[model samples]
Target: MQSAIETARKQLPKIRIELVDCYTGSAAQALIALTAARAVKLGDNLNQIIPKVNKVIPEAEITLVLDTLKYLERGGRAPKIGAWATSLLKIKPVVTNRMGHAHFLGMARSRTQGIERMIRTMRGKIGLNRVSAIIIHSELETEAKELEHRLRSEFNCNETYVTEISAVVAVHLGPGAIGIAFLPS
Candidate 1:
């Protein structure tokens, strides 16, 4: 991604191109890009768009519930012993992206509990603003649909997207993973 940005800068030297790193997951990163697109469509220049994008960065939120941690262990993000322990106990981890990395938020004995926790956190942080959300899942369309329905009925969202996790992300999240990414509108 950095290399792509560098190439774009070299190709358009006169136009100021700044790279802002959110250090978050793909969903949050995608939200920042979508925000920039909206700004540009509204005829905002770099100066105007940068701050809007910045505002969304800190407010960006993602809550992930993974059914298994094998991928995380394989990806070297989690210890093998810990992954085995969680699996043995049937503990589901609720992770939130912070500064480009996954941070453990809490644990649930069941997937339903994990999803509930995620929604509560999102509602608390979003306050009264209308939001836009993306539902990402790795072989968990049913769970993602439940999450999407909740987001639409319980929150003020102008747009809600549901997409499968990319292969790169799927490698870390494994199958039966579900998450929500949201930003204020």
Candidate 2:
């Protein structure tokens, strides 16, 4: 990113370019981007927006429930043996972002159980604080909507969004993957 920024600066000396690594991906990254955009919309200059974006980098978090570990094994993100074991037991893997990497949380025997674990994780993180959240899924709109409803009902959410996971991310998570990204406001 720095290289790209330098290259662009040479071509357009008057233009300003800033890059921020949110230390996370998927919906968490989206939330960080939204923070900067909101700051800009409120008439904040680049300097002001950078600080706001940085402040959110640590606060934002994402948790995912994958239907299977096949895709992760295929992508070389998981060991073949682990994937096979998970498949054999029919367990959904629960994952969360920590220090910019996907960290395994636990496993659920069913999708509904996985979603409940996700909600519990979020509740533990934010407690009664108001939050902003995004519920993301891959080819699972109905489940995503249900997750959204559950989140709103259980938490003090100031804003909530439901969205389809990007195709690039879905390629690795595969179908039936559901995730939630939240920021305590």
lDDT of each: 0.87, 0.91
Clash pairs, candidate 2, are: none
**Model 2 stretches with alpha carbons more than 4 Å out:** none
**Which stretches in model 1 have alpha-carbon errors above 4 Å?**
1-3
Candidate 1 lDDT over residue span 32-146, tens digit each = 7999999999999999999998887988888899997878999999899879977999989898986676688889999899999889889898867799899999888887888
Candidate 2: tens digits of C-alpha lDDT, residues 30-122: 888989888989999999999999988999999999999899899998889878988999999999995498789999999999998999999
Question: Lowest lDDT 10-mer window, candidate 1?
Answer: 97-106
